[model samples]
Target: MSLSHEIMKNICGYSRAKYSTWFYYRPDHILFDAGEGVSLALRNMIYGIDHIFISHNHGDHIGGLPGLIKSRASSMGDITKPLSIYYPEKDSQILQFKEYLDVSIPKLPFVLTWKGLRPGDQISLNANRFVEAFASDHMGTLSLGYKIIEKRKRLKSEYKGLPQQELIACIKDLGREAIHEEYHKNLLVYSGDTMPLDVSIVQNAEVLLHDATFVLGSDREENTHATVEEACELAIKAQVACLALFHFSSRYSHQQVKDKIYEIITANNVEIPIHYIYPHFYPSDFKQIQIEN
Candidate 1:
């Protein structure tokens, strides 16, 4: 195939204060976090996605489930592919979800799968893609983040001049599986909601969606959320290609949050481009702008 960037499609990640709703497209299908008004966004993005990933059981995280399931059923979606949900089987939240699925969406024409995730659990999604769920610092209930990645051989930039036919021949001679064993890279890491911690689990991910709720002491320790400084510390430590700061507290204005985060990360010599997810309450554009460097 010709060299082309994957069609990236993330419009919004936060509905209002402290809410997450995002749309991400991998090579296979679109993905999203369960949140209020997420169904409408998903419909606008792609026809019913086969896979849906939820971060936690907070109201903001799961409040959208009811509507989403109903909409799909009402729309007459023929979900031949099973909808797989990767979430931690914590408290009675699963029971609530089940009740919603049973009563609200009593006629689910699709198969649904659920699995209890723990630290070090790796979900090999496809031939060359994998998602790893690790322990997040967020408490109150079980919360998790995901790392999307390529588990195949790296393409050397030095081999650009070689024709594809030649490369195919070389691969055939050397055995494609043998070459795939070397040079794999992590592509993306998403921290649903968490305090600052070492993000080495997703080290070098091309994209990182991390929590940046507090900007200079916006919240108390009773509710732990990472400040801009802390978020940058984790990003700088992981050395990811890009950082998408999200889950902002209701306190800061859009400009105030960005300005505060940009200033601190810059001062600390954090060089990776930082992106922000605008809350729905903000009238500003949801377009996430990144730094030049």
Candidate 2:
């Protein structure tokens, strides 16, 4: 299978604009925005999560924390595993959620840590991969987006086109770093509850999960969330290999949502694969439709 397809199979989540929004990226054991029903949806898989990244403090985005934490403590999973949570710096709403967890689960068995982060802050997932935060334009809150970046080494510009034997000799003489340059590849990007993001933030990502809360631009009474077309446009401009739109408003029917996305894809001649979570689908039945490229 293609790398993008393999990555898609590992991700599962549910999103409804005003109700809930969350994503569980299995490969990294990272949960983005623990929304309502997260614990129930994830069930035993809750034990696999090593980190939770909160975009903002909206209740819909953080309501699942208490359940998730409590379940990990009381459920059949390993109770001593450490769990870390990262969120936008000084978000009062998230602080309130933490306080609630403290009161609700005072005697937790695990070592839970919460750290505040800024837009440029980065948390290492491993030696070569890390999660980086970036600002997002979600009104009424200090929202942020996240990028999963992988650090890779490549031959320096001057060393390109050299014969294989010559390259080996050069590598031995100059050492690896001297002949190589490091570049960051964006594996995935999640724009949590935001309007259309700046292209630069999600450029060239293998996958982009963006907010698409409105089927039509005219349906938006407020500019808090992006419309489906806007999200697709941004994905195209950013050159993302795959786009998975979530956080759709519950007002639209499944057919309406699918039709609108199809219209956008056809009208723009979008070549990259597009996927979306139908808001009406139950969490247990949650499966994104991968629109043909």
- TM-score of model 2 vs. true structure: 0.96
lDDT of 2 by residue, 36-78 (tens): 9999999999999999999998889998998999999999989
Top candidate when judged by lDDT against the true structure = 2
- Candidate 1 residue lDDT tens string, 1-293: 21111222333345454555554554545364677777766563333466666677777777777777666655645544456767765646866776667775665766766676776677777888777777777776777777776765655665456788987986889766544445557676777777875766767777777777787774656556777777787778888777777777767787888788768766787766677766744321344445557
lDDT of each: 0.66, 0.89
lDDT of 1 at 229: 77
Worst 10 residues of 2 by lDDT: 284-293
- lDDT of prediction 2: 0.89
All models, RMSD in angstroms? 4.6, 1.6
TM per model?
A: 0.80, 0.96
